[model samples]
Target: MNAASPASPLLEVRGLRMHFPVSEGLLGRKVGDVKAVDGIDFTVRRGETLGLVGESGCGKTTTGRCVLRLEKPTAGQIIFDGVDIASLGGKQLQALRQRIQVIFQDPYSSLNPRMTIGQIIAEPMFVHGIEPNATKRMERVHELLTICGLNAGFADRYPHEMSGGQRQRVGIARALAMNPEFIVCDEPVSALDVSIQAQVVNLLEDLREKFGLTYLFIAHDLSVVRHLCQRVAVMYLGHIVEMADSDTLFDNPQHPYTRALLAAVPVPDPDVEQGREFRPVKGEVPSPMNPPSGCVFHPRCPMAVDRCSKEAPQPREIAPGHMVACSEVKITG
Candidate 1:
């Protein structure tokens, strides 16, 4: 794992919310909101990867999308490099896109099947008017392909012509084409095969070190998150239940949800796997459109009390750099 940077935050999300309006009828009248991302805050220090891990529909992807500005947020601020990008528009937003890039989850659909690998990687540079010379653009594309662990010859090939792993490498190359400072990797290796996942994850780690890149990595694979992220933020029903360094969160999880999540990850040792009891988190995830009162995870939280059903738990710093949103948890030295 990359060391956590002590540098100032490259990105800060404060009370960020993305509430999709639930509509009905031909007129599309709004009934309620699908609270994808409720009020939540976190930061990605320069050159550090912050993992956002949660169950499906917990708003991990939505939070990343809000950062990329793919979806306009319903509330809060996305402060990047000291500028609040939540309200940026026109040329300003367009310029910001160059600094922040995304590597999508699906390799098959994220790329243009019609374009060659070279064209795919070059498209971003072309749109942004980087490497204006045609020959230089092609050279840059070849260089990026090589940097992403693909053969330079692969540039002539189309998306359909390459394997799943190669396609994802192309996707990474495309993101790097913009020379971005921060990248939102939305499950970038989740779709690939197990062996391929390792290769891609290693590639990402190498690229981060080589280019000094910061990432907001969103994934459901706690194992991968533990390996790749320096710090982790656990989300549940649109709220961050826990946030801590990877080692601390995995080894000494305080929140009930976080403990359950770590418990769910299969241990590699056969003896331990057989001996350990598996206790999955009880209850299905609640609907975000109408979340329960008080703590969102109270229904499933083992440590929950009567007050948990009435008062929402604000995130409290229990130790230096470790935050938990549970009334039952105590501060530690």
Candidate 2:
């Protein structure tokens, strides 16, 4: 679908679906499709972080990759800066890619250890034809290194020579080198030490403020999302169960799954946090290849009613900017 205006959403994902074929035989015969990101919709405002939170295999990462056009979606549209990129051809996609970037999770594996930090950061500039002068590239690379809190001299060192935090900083520098307006941060700090995670996240926050970057921060850690994202979208079995401003979702979660997720967040207060009143999400997440009928989460929802097992709830706006898709959802938080 071609977007109607050149002034439309900076990033608008509607009914995005990415289903991977599942093969069961030793010969790898196709048996089913893993309904990863199924019919999910959300928007990223020009300069805010929209945290995509969910359990493992809930397709948060798949959604991010689809937005980046790294993986082609099975359905729906990805409208970015007034262009629907979902159906863009390879040549067209390449041209539009310069404005979007990604900061991957594992800094160690994300960067080529064989390459020097300066080269890693300079490569983006070279690829985009932003700064072809070797001297200018060097100058820009050093400047970015400084901004990411690494010394200019450290640019000659390979990724393996630096700590996880430092490698992540290099990754951030590479992402910023192209002056991208939108970024998909796929669990950027999940693999780092807790102390290092803070530094990387803080750097990302500062960069966002300084460069006016929009981010789709996908992570399983809700606490990190609460701190970084302006709004939060919770996914379950390839569908968004709830979405609201960060504070609203954390303080007064509506859907049963969301409430369970928040309750599971470890609070510092051991006494109150350990109480029996809090309920851990029950049962295992259903297999995506064989998801339950009606509500995908009905089997595990404590408040699931008879209707929940037979009919899927439509996502509806309960508050000004909050939407949830659970019929038995009650906001008691």
Candidate 3:
């Protein structure tokens, strides 16, 4: 499944957009569109984790869904392993699924309460015609459970019989059953306790190494993103405002939104924390349905200039791999 080389990234998304049409009346005449994801682009290199981070409503989840083909895009290409999957259909798309999978955010709601854990994990294998025999599928299920750090005996139990962390692990086991090359980890650790969160993050890192899996890790937790991702992309109102290696992005955030977000990450040092003057971004996140013209983030950006409200800034590579979409920040490559 790892059919990628240095010549190309495992996942390359260009101008991807997902807009939910707004309608009026029972006839459903389209009046407007909710621009959940609007013209965003990035690439997830093979064996690397690219974090898609933003506030809750900034369309990071929608972008992940579009990449997985759970939601079809309005425009643009979702190229996976040298093929554009956004346009695939029928058997072509079905076959392509073997190389891609998703681990959802809510473990409880994602799993079926009616099905036993063994059946749940084995369903994907059976659907994809992986393990044909019942006994073999069960064995594979048990093995997957073990790989996800769950006991083999737990496979016989229902999702309700497990805790939040266990259920999330089961979800991971399900995704892994496909031997996927890329997995969209949509806030996989967000629902767990702080201690459990660390365990899950570590498990994902281990699996990535073990499988050479690529990830589009979507989350709002900057700390968690810093912990797990190699590269990070910051999104605001459906646009990637800035992107860089995790260390570079955290150490030297170039966008106003990015700086505001880092300012919010709590510091453990009481002396530093007490003395720090954090200025949270001003104004509420504007409605995506009626987003402001020019720069979408200008309404909340403290350093916004008159030009920021009049023209959108194009994304520029400020330094090697570091890209920022802002006109105000002056820098030299």
Candidate 4:
């Protein structure tokens, strides 16, 4: 479902900006802002999956962290279920955390080596004061392990003893402990093997349907994003260049950057691949700290114009629900 629906957004972000100050000199005087996530906005609907995709350092992870209060936003309004979380402080922020959970990129790193799987899963319940009895917490831990396809006996084992896929299951079990309606999947399968990736993705889909959860699925891989996300947003240099339903964006990409990204994906058939008039993208990505004036992507864009160099294009809905931020979105015939 689209975020604009009056039923209300599970999570809504408006004019979100996360800038890191570049302090220089002996006195640590502010020189300039990194502009890591300079003024981008979007939303997550209740029980829906929204994928945030970009090349590395495009600020996808930063945006997710800002929304979850893992990192404080430099400026923006973050409204969660009608409550403005960005303006909240102290006890309120802690209370808000129970509703939002995060699954990190590396499962091995995320799971504590010292803690057993059961203890790891039950940690959130203990923090939230959800279970008073030790016995009850253990039971809940067993239930979670089972839900994520792990045997109850496996809970006694440490993270190191488990395979990459198993460790990830434990991670998922931990996230589910709080019964959170929303979760930030911060590239949950990026580090796993190819065989493991599909299983993890399928597990996520199963969990979403079973639990009625919403997700901000952050990833750099387009193939992964298309498989898991209902709607997709493509970010570039701290801004969303294009957003649309998965079918529309993948089948008929509007933005030049998106097209270039897709072109890099390998075609299944060699004959068709050989026939393709490939226009491989060139040039190194410009530094975000000292980004170009007009469009951030104009420097690397193949079909750049003089106007593109000087004029920044706002994201506009040229089609019914598809939005693009490019002066020219002319795909070859």
Candidate 5:
């Protein structure tokens, strides 16, 4: 695939919000909204991997879902290749699916038990009418299996017959089968064994380079994100609190939450790990249905001041391509 201009973004999300209505009683009267993703914005440059990292309920997955158009946003824009897809449906959305694909977190649940691996991978092609010929589809499946580091023979086996790592490789093959330009990897390796995680991550990295694919990689594992993504975005309570190049954000995190998250990552060396100051974030994440006023993180922020409780902070660029959303943090050139 030919790479798009390096400066042009393949995907751009602006003020994306997914607020699920909370209801009560059989009447199902809406009482409140669970703000899963609230007004977060970011861009994925063509052929670059952008990592979205946060706690389990911090809305990282929600953001990715909104981008995939699986959940309609309450209000915002999801631009894919310069077209707004947030409200698209029918044939248009179906057409968009051909260019964008997702590799889910759980390999066990994502694959079909009844379908053979060949059928599972070929299903997308069939739905999109990519390969109409039965022989050609099977041949394409074998090629994809080999590309994903699996033997072509595995195509005849069922999902129950493969190991977890092998199952995940099958999932990767399925995503690639679409010939997608962009992919959403929602913690693709999080369910695998630690040893297997590295292999899967490496495979994803290799595949991206080979195909010049763009990725919106949603993961909680900072180490994995650092290994695979060129840029990283840190989310807190439905908002992106910080973003920067992977190296810059990992080494010099500006937001309080970003700093705490990095601190929580365990160092492999005992001497370094033990010597490093480890302070867990003070409190549990607040409920998104009734998030705290002003900055949602103020309640848990150690550096929070009185103003942080009364005034929300918008993301401000402190340095080139490094944004931080904290009132207390000083901007440095």
Candidate 6:
């Protein structure tokens, strides 16, 4: 799949599906499948941060994994820089790893406790056949550590010796070691202290500008996504229900699901917040093994009609760049 054009998105996922089969019986015959990422589509433009936000188990993380080819999509096209990566194998796939990277959610378990910080960061460079010389690798490790706001001398320290925030910085350093053009930041700040979260977010923003990198920032924290992303895409039960620019989406959310999510956010002003309405999202998320027919969110959606429960809504542009998948949405200025 050649890139559609020079102005095409850096990463494009079309109809991506990842289904893990569930088997039961003496022979463990296939009985069901966990539809982790069920036919989702989105894109990340060059040098842009696209936020993927959703409740737990809504496939936000799974989508990120599919893009990185960590979890092979059962179906769909994962086009990176105009090449269809989902079909690549051997050296082709191996080479693609250097251009795309991931920073895991948990820093404690992500790094090897036995390895020193320098070795941890240099591992990717070595695997990619980059910075092969031992002396040069050490120098590059120090430079990456410094760039990620860690002390250069801490290269000799083990994972057990670092704080949570520090460990995350090392994780970031490792991801940067490959000099990737795109990164999957999978809740990179969720495990840190509130104060530390801000620092890490700021650092990511700075690094994006410095490296000219694009990011698929997956997180449940709306405020954090608002702070970091230029555009936001809301996922529900393996489908993107709404997508729009940060300011436009926040100010004028059209989908009922999107409205429900934004309504749950806490406002800072006591008096104004007290007067504002709060509509708790109704019903627990449905099981992905056998998700509801039609719109997955219709069961929990307050505004769902008979049609919503019978037919799936296709994405349609309501404004310049705002797209909503709910048929109930009425476009108005």
TM-score of each: 0.97, 0.94, 0.97, 0.94, 0.98, 0.96
Candidate 4 residue spans exceeding 4 A from truth: 1-7, 330-333
lDDT of 3 by residue, 105-177 (tens): 9999999999999999999999989889999999999999999999999988999999999999999999999
* lDDT value, residue 118 of candidate 3: 98
lDDT (Cα atoms) of all candidates against the true structure: 0.94, 0.89, 0.92, 0.88, 0.94, 0.91
Residues 232-322 of candidate 4: C-alpha lDDT, one tens digit per residue: 9999999999998888889999898999999988777999899888878998777779989898899889878989889998888878768
lDDT of 2 by residue, 142-216 (tens): 999999999999989998899888888999999989888899999999999987888888989999999988899
Clashing pairs in 3: none
List per-candidate RMSD values in Å. Answer: 2.7, 2.7, 1.4, 2.8, 1.4, 1.7
Error of 2 at 110 (Å): 0.6
Clash counts for all predictions: 0, 0, 0, 0, 0, 1
Task: State how far residue 85 of model 6 sits from its true place (Å).
Answer: 0.8
Location of the lowest summed lDDT over 10 successive residues in candidate 5: 1-10
Residue 1 lDDT in candidate 4: 28
Give residue 319's lDDT in candidate 2 (0 to 100). 81
Candidate 2: which pairs clash? none
How much does candidate 4 score in TM-score? 0.94
